[model samples]
Target: MSTTALSSSSTGSTGQPPPRRKAPRRPKPAPGTQRISPLRVIGLTVVWLFTAFNLLVLYWLIMAAFKTPLEIFREPLSLPATLFERGTPFRNFVYAWESAEFGTAFLNTVILVAVCSVVIVLVSAPAAYALSRLGVRGSGPMTAFIAIGMGVPFQTVIIPLFIAMSEIDLNNNLFGLALIYVALSLPFTVFLLTGFFRSLPDELEEAASIDGASATRTFWSIMLPLARGGLITALILNAIGLWNETLLAIVFLQENANFTLARALFTFYNAASYQSEYGGLLAGVAIIVLPMLVMYILLARRIITGLTLGAGK
Candidate 1:
């Protein structure tokens, strides 16, 4: 080889800038827009404004619960005059409770919610286990049939239920109300728990069976305990429904004493003397709403988890 060629080859890369590195290709915008649309901005603003207005209304209602009838009108936006008033500062709550017979309604509602919620969880859990895990014949068709009840409006059956109750001498009774709540509650509970139960590992059941546990014991002792989150969700849902149920309560319970809180609220509202006692009425509304608010706060995680657990699967 020539000396010049050998020298050039040994030196290599003579004076060329290293080939420019390709910059990471940015994702190009699809078609148009460097800026957000005005309409989208306006829509977001309106949603925020609506949310703020609702929060303000809730705050006002809660404050009104502590105010007197006159204060509710004259100084509607003011805070309570004093926190240390004699007797009870929340006398409006007491007055509403007693005068509206809400005390009785509260007891009746509590009974209905508690009893029906418990019964629904108990009844649904076993049925869900059977449908989801036991592989029994016709379980799929049975589940589908039960699920149809969810789409069936309660209004459709009210007349028949009322007639049946009347013929059986069960009308206006709290127990009868509870039974109705349970029936109405079952479809959702079964659907929810069935999905939740199906999400569970079959290995757990197999382990229980291998350890000489009977199917019944495995279900009650092993399966039920694992399904607590779904059970609690069903319980809360049924309780809320039964607690706020008005149509059936008013229809089945012609007697004031037999009225649930929801029916009593309707009665209180129609009585219309409440305009003079808006604070008391507000307190009564708060009373009816408090349990649900508390439940939502306490079990929010479980509730969200249970409801969404079935969505993907």
Candidate 2:
């Protein structure tokens, strides 16, 4: 009677204890795998801190450019007094541009960057096309040989380059500097663009060939247009590199009038007579840094994607 009563209670009141649930099974990793550790979290935290520190420094540098020499020293952490004014109160920019001859240097650097970057990309694209697409024997070896040039230090060649240019009477010529920049930039450019070209679909090239497109015509009309992302990234990188390049410019260039921004800024910093000139120095720095920063911000996505694509292969 007691057992019957218990069975009736289980059925009517509790509904058979609602069926016991099985615990979820954990997935096992492969035998060679190591378990995750706290190091990853620590590493990520450090990287974030470093990035924040860099941004803070950039902010301070830019803001420091707007203050007067005395005012900069007196109030290093504060914003420019002209913040309350209608327009930018960065008078030091004008002073740096005119007094420091940064205006002339800026023009020289612009010309050099534009010419060199365009030529490097143009020259590299064809070479990269040949290296990556051609089925010729020894092509792989040739690519490896070209890539080996990347490890060569500039210091090793600087003296020889200077001597060669001096012999040709092109030592101080802007065109000479452009040529040098193009040559030095080629190894990396070819290497980068080769990978990028290889990553593209071979089916496209095959179709072009099937359609009676010449090799030259196919690369020019189809591949070049499709590689715009990588091309732009290369151009921007080359421009930025050549823009701030100081050692080569200083060695190859002779005249003050021909100074690139790096050389001009170096001269400006050294020529400062008093602490009051710090503002102008910072302004000069901002002039060199701001354009690249703006370019990076605008095309950051393209740069990352293009570079990623190049590296993917």
Per-model TM-score on C-alpha atoms: 0.80, 0.85
* TM-score quality measure for candidate 2: 0.85
Residue 304's lDDT in candidate 1:
85
Looking at candidate 2, what is the lDDT of residue 138?
A: 85
lDDT of 1 by residue, 1-313 (tens): 9997777766666833456689999997653354686766887799999999987887888888898767788887888664336547878888788878988888888877898889998999999999999999999999999999999999999899989999999997888887888888899899989998998888999999899999899999998888787888888877777777788888888788888888888788756363677777888899988888788889888888878876555
Query: Every model's Cα RMSD, please?
Result: 4.9, 6.8
Winner by lDDT: 2
The residue ranges of model 1 lying beyond 4 angstroms of the native Cα positions read 1-50, 69-76, 80-88, 272-275
Off by over 4 Å in 2: 1-37, 82-88, 273-276
Superposition error at 17 for model 1 (Å): 17
Number of the top candidate by TM-score? Answer: 2
